[model samples]
Target: MQSVVPSPEGLAWAQRLVRLDTVSEHSNLELIETIADHLRTLGVPLRLTRDESGRKANLFATLGAPRPGGVILSGHTDTVPWDGQVWSEDPLSGSVHDGRLWGRGSADMKGFIGLVVARTRAWLEADLPLPLHYAFSYDEEVGCFGVRHLIADLKDAGIAPAACIVGEPTQMLPALAHKGVHRWRCCVKGRAAHSSLAPRAVNAIEAAARLVTVVADMGERWRREGPFQHGFDVPHSTAAVGVIAGGIADNIVPADCRFNYEFRELPGSDAQAMQAEVRAAAAALEPAMQAVDPATGFAFEPICSIPAFSADADEPAVRLARRLAGGGETTLVAFGTEAGLFQRAGISTVVCGPGSIAQAHQADEYVTLEQLARCEAFLDGLRRPAAAC
Candidate 1:
């Protein structure tokens, strides 16, 4: 089969996708349906999974007839919100300028999705011995949320691919391991009272501040304590509080406050244990608040849990990814992706894709045409029998 490069044609396809504005907050059905219809026309086997309301959808299409072993090319259809970003061109322009595809989803993933779509015809015509599965998902920007159900569906259907390649921006390099991302929301309930009666009032903001301090302290400990993995840029499990909210007047003691925090743990480390530690610290603070009033306490809500992913360099998925993408030392990335969920589902998985993560989810986000060209070559490589590994 001739090479199918991700060029102006592929960029055009990506622009059409970016134009849809499938931000995680909005429904991704539009993007998924369009892709599903295209795949249907190619005579591919399709599985469409949706949320209870049918607002979001995950399209799992098989280019060739399903069989025991094969490779899965996976990407998320949703992009991060760009409500406040300033750009020289329309964010959805998919404009080709200075050798780059300028668009919101170009770097993060839609670029790879476009490349895969561009080569769907080639893949269908070739029909390599090993099957190929395109697992494009939704709400990946929020968390590895939709892919969880998608993987469950695949399991229930007994459609187990031998390996999966998640198209998360990695400059077309193969990422062998990445940290797990765990996020949670904590609420502090306290007694409101006039500022003059400080002794009687249980300050939720103050209590929440203490809890955030605990999170910071734990983060510091991880930085100093050993369990360090050298490959990761941070080289340690990390934690941070991203959002906090509460109260009205400064004169009144805040009755309630909530904060969101997350921990990105190194592979083989216990993020759950660290989360428990934060909860325990919050519990200790509650006793003081409860002393003012029995109703004063703290509550916790889980946002998401994405396990860390690590594959031995010699793993079949990693080997095939390196070979297809051109050999280089496999690296670990700090960001999270659905690859972790895929790995947890018993499918060997690797992270390999176009563009640079630095360009993702920010103003002027774009994927260089050079990178897309490399990705196209990788997709073309899959058409060969050697990609069966």
Candidate 2:
């Protein structure tokens, strides 16, 4: 089969997709419906599946005959928030300048999604020997929720891909591994009292401060004593508190305090064990706080768990990705992505797409026209049948 090059129409489609503001928190139902309709017209078999909330959705489309070993092109439809950044152009306008497409999700994701959709037309036109599956997910910027359902559906149907290429921006290089992210919220409960008589009441804020100190101490210990074999810039797990809230007034002892923390762990590290350490520290603090007043307590709730993915350098999928990416050496990234989840589902996965991670989650995120063109060529190569070994 002959691989088809990206058409002008495909570029136009990508531009239109960039115009839709599907920020992770915003509803992506319209975008999902539009893509589903477009795939149906392109002779791709598409099924629209929704999570329990229906605020977001997943679209699974396939080309060529269904088979055991196929290729899955995956991308997230949601983007990070662009709430407080100064932009040279309208963030959602998909403006083009200097041969680059600029928009909210131009780099973080929608660019890759557009490329995959554009290539779908070529796959549909050719008589490919292997099937090509496209999985578009929502809320990836928040957590890996949308694809979890899609993966479960595929597993339920006993359909597993031979390989999955997650179109996360890698500047056209192949990424074989990335760190995992674990997010949690901790709450400290205490009794409130007048500042003048604070000794009689337990202060939630004070308890939370101790908890934060424990987290910082643990982070430092991990940096000093933890394994550091990974190639990540940090080279070890990192923990930090991102948000905190407590207190009513300077005069009153706070009754409740809450904060969210995250851990970016290296591949193969025990993320759960790290979380356990934090929990234990919080628990130990609780007894002290409760001794001041029997009402003090602590609780921890998980927000998200993103697993890490690392493929062996000699793996067939990595080799295929290198070839498709024009023979660049495989590398690792510190950010989290859905590639790990796909790999855990028994699909050899690699991360290779257009643009650079530097531009992701920025105000005027953009993807160079050159990178887009390279991605188009990569997809075209995949459409062609393999030569005899």
The numbered model that scores best in lDDT is 1
Angstrom error at residue 190, model 1:
0.5
Candidate 1: misplaced stretches above 4 Å? 1-5
CA lDDT of 78 in candidate 1?
89
Backbone clashes in model 1, listed as residue pairs: none
Residue pairs with colliding backbones in model 2 are: none
The TM-score obtained by model 1 is: 0.97
lDDT of 2 by residue, 1-389 (tens): 53323357656767878999898888898889888888888767876679788888999888888777778889999988777888888899887778888898887788878878767767777788688889999888888999999999898878877888888998888998888999999988999999998998898888888888888887888799986856676888888999999999999999999999898888888889988988888777777677888778889999999998888886756777788877867777878999999989988888988889989998789988778887888877786677000
lDDT of 1: 0.88
lDDT, candidates in the order shown: 0.88, 0.84
Error of 1 at 53 (Å): 1.9
lDDT per residue (tens digit) for residues 114-202 in model 1: 88887888878896869989899988888878888899999999998999999898988899999999999998888889999989999
Instruction: Please give each candidate's TM-score.
Output: 0.97, 0.95
Candidate 2: segments with Cα more than 4 A from true spot? 1-7, 387-389
